[model samples]
Target: MKILVFCGFIFFLAIFPLSGAGFELKTVIDQVSRQVVVPAAPQRVIALAPSITEIIFALEQENRLKGVTAYSDFPKKALKLPKVGSYVYLDLERIVSLKPDLCIAIKDGNPKEAVDKLESIGIPVYAVNPKNIETVINTVVEIGGLLNASKKADALAKNMRHRIKRVEALIAKTDLRPGIFFQIGIAPIVSVGTDTFIHELIIKAGGRNLAEGPVSYPRFSREQVLALAPDIIIITSMARSVVFEQVKAEWNKWPNMPAVKTGRIFLEDSNLFDRPTPRLVDGLELLLKLIHPELINEANKCL
Candidate 1:
């Protein structure tokens, strides 16, 4: 009877571990979309988007980045990393050679087939799509969690929230809200409308978007733009040649426009404005300065 009891106790110990299982930790899901699962703390990470690379660097996980895309120009050190081609077209051979455990990509930037191929080869991929400022913060936190830098990510997110609140407070003190028109791409004349990250930024920067009614990025007619009569016109210098001289000359022809008459046309770095990362705080501060230079004190001029 003593031997049987001892055997039963051993059996119970073995089954207890399996039954309780210590409650397996739940994998975090990407908030933008529930489909993607954050991989367990990646060691060798490849950032397919410049924005993702910036976020990783902000989280101080630059050492973990095995490879980065061609356009990641920030931090200067990122330039030394091996290039994985452009966001739209990746160098599959180079990526496979690097043997990265995980690849971080943007939703629209990376191709579906490339992601599938990487997954088939036993590499995990986390595709992030941050449509607005709030989502951008969440993406950073998620990336941090995936990289085992949860504390850093939380701190970064908190800092960004505080900066945004400061900007909001400044805007609320004044009733002056300028009507803004943001130019995304010229030539065909693409502009940020409602439901765009840029549109949200404009609102946060204490400016009202002139391009409304249309949801996503839409091409505007010259006549339609004239009708909006924006108080301030902001153009992104994303293109190789920011042709500010040419743009100013063209706007000069439209004498009736408020922006043209008042010379409220300003140029901003497209990468900083368009990329949804921690640097976006810089862009917001710049936007505020441009929109209401009067609110900025003499000491804040350096900003």
Candidate 2:
């Protein structure tokens, strides 16, 4: 997972740029309350973050996407798009070369300087900041509105809400909240805190996050983790699959650990957990299944 931290969500409207041949220039506010002028029907757009690219693709607005940041390799087609560098370290020259009429950025990941520089050079940048599942759905809808795909965005948002409610309803039926140790970093042995998306998912999926605190992604020693005695250990890393298996094997050595004893240590796709996209709902359901296998049938029904 790309570690792009987030805050609360914001709502904004679309505006038309007057200079673009047939388009009119109009000012609109972004998620961060920054005023941007863009074309009403932007033909060339750039996604400054992988998650933003995913959202635009989900909205079926990829036709306007002229460029995307590195690792925006979802939907298969994004692989063919021009790269403007990663979200954190943006390539201003490459981005400017693309001649994009609009650029969608994530407030958390995309560097502020890059955004300001783009705006200064007459490139309209719309930003989004989605901190949790609910806001992520809102972001989908908001991006849809920005791209003239409100109908699709609304439908997608509705579907996301439906799935989230299903998880909530199913979770309400159980008092079984497993103590979970979610490891995101394998080298230094790090876990999510209460403020992170994974921690929120854990709680919503009926698992108690053992690493909940103020420090966001916190590091821990093996002894410290064992002392916590988590019921389930879920490891999500950007590392290769073999590395995950090796980590699992290492955890298996601790037979006394409940998760190892019960063969509950699992490896998951980090993107589903970290990316602030519609796929997070998918991650939530997966967490539900892992935390409570007994609810598999009911969870399927909920889906």
Candidate 3:
């Protein structure tokens, strides 16, 4: 689906033709939903998702950023940016008031109605779907091409790929794959199923996900989780330490569980594991180390 465009303006500066950086940029295609044009040197940009904001900052295009959705605070400077709304639902009026030339979004996170409304208003919205680890990697490259920062994007994508490969190499040398339970939500005991980025990363990080439900995020009962017999339990919560610890303590009641008996439960930074950004690599490294303590030293190398 790669189309060649005139990169006459970008060709001479930091030329990265492979990532489609130069005088030309390609249209963003999202699951047959919409095609968006990337304006050359877009003046005002609005990021509708945290991950999109991180990508823009990674490419050092924060200056072009005029507005962002709630919780788009990765690069310290972003905190000062104006907020249009949360990724869950945007303040259309506020976003339009920003007068951005381009608005970035996530197909899964942003409401289609909102994106369509923005498009109708003549503001270009480029939405990407990072459904899996591979698509997450591709996002960095694609975003870089759109911002004319192909070189930086290529390097970032290469680094993530290299780190992921390192984990895979370590996993290949191991025969024992631990069964892991990733607890994301406390109420109703929610966890990621096979249809999620976390699930894919768990498999790639040399572990088996115990919660294999139908949806991306599935609700599990206490008895159901106990039957799974997970070897390890990992918690990812954006809540305060007190709240997160309390959530972990809830699992403590099941002392007979293999994970509880072995004290294999771990608390991870929610920002790393929860976000579909470059930090997913960080999350994967930690996951690998937790699953195989023997790879603790090897995990550092991947990061």
Q: Relative to the unseen true structure, what is the C-alpha lDDT of residue 188 in candidate 1, on a scale of 0 to 100?
A: 69
Each model's lDDT: 0.79, 0.85, 0.80
Error of 2 at 34 (Å): 1.4
Q: Give the TM-score of candidate 1.
A: 0.84
Please provide, for model 1 over 119-227, each residue's C-alpha lDDT reduced to its tens digit, 9 standing for 90 to 100.
5555567789888788899999988888889999999999999999988888887788899989876776778878877777888888888886466888987778888
Best by TM-score: 2
Reference-based TM-score, model 3: 0.86
* Candidate 3 deviant stretches above 4 angstroms: 1-33, 298-303
Total clashing pairs for each candidate: 0, 9, 4
Over 4 Å off in model 1, which ranges?
A: 1-28, 31-41, 240-242, 298-303
Please report the candidate that would top lDDT against the real structure: 2
Structural similarity to truth (TM-score) of each candidate: 0.84, 0.91, 0.86
User: Which of candidates 2 and 3 is the stronger one according to lDDT?
Assistant: 2
Q: Which stretches of candidate 2 lie over 4 Å from their true place?
A: 1-21, 298-303
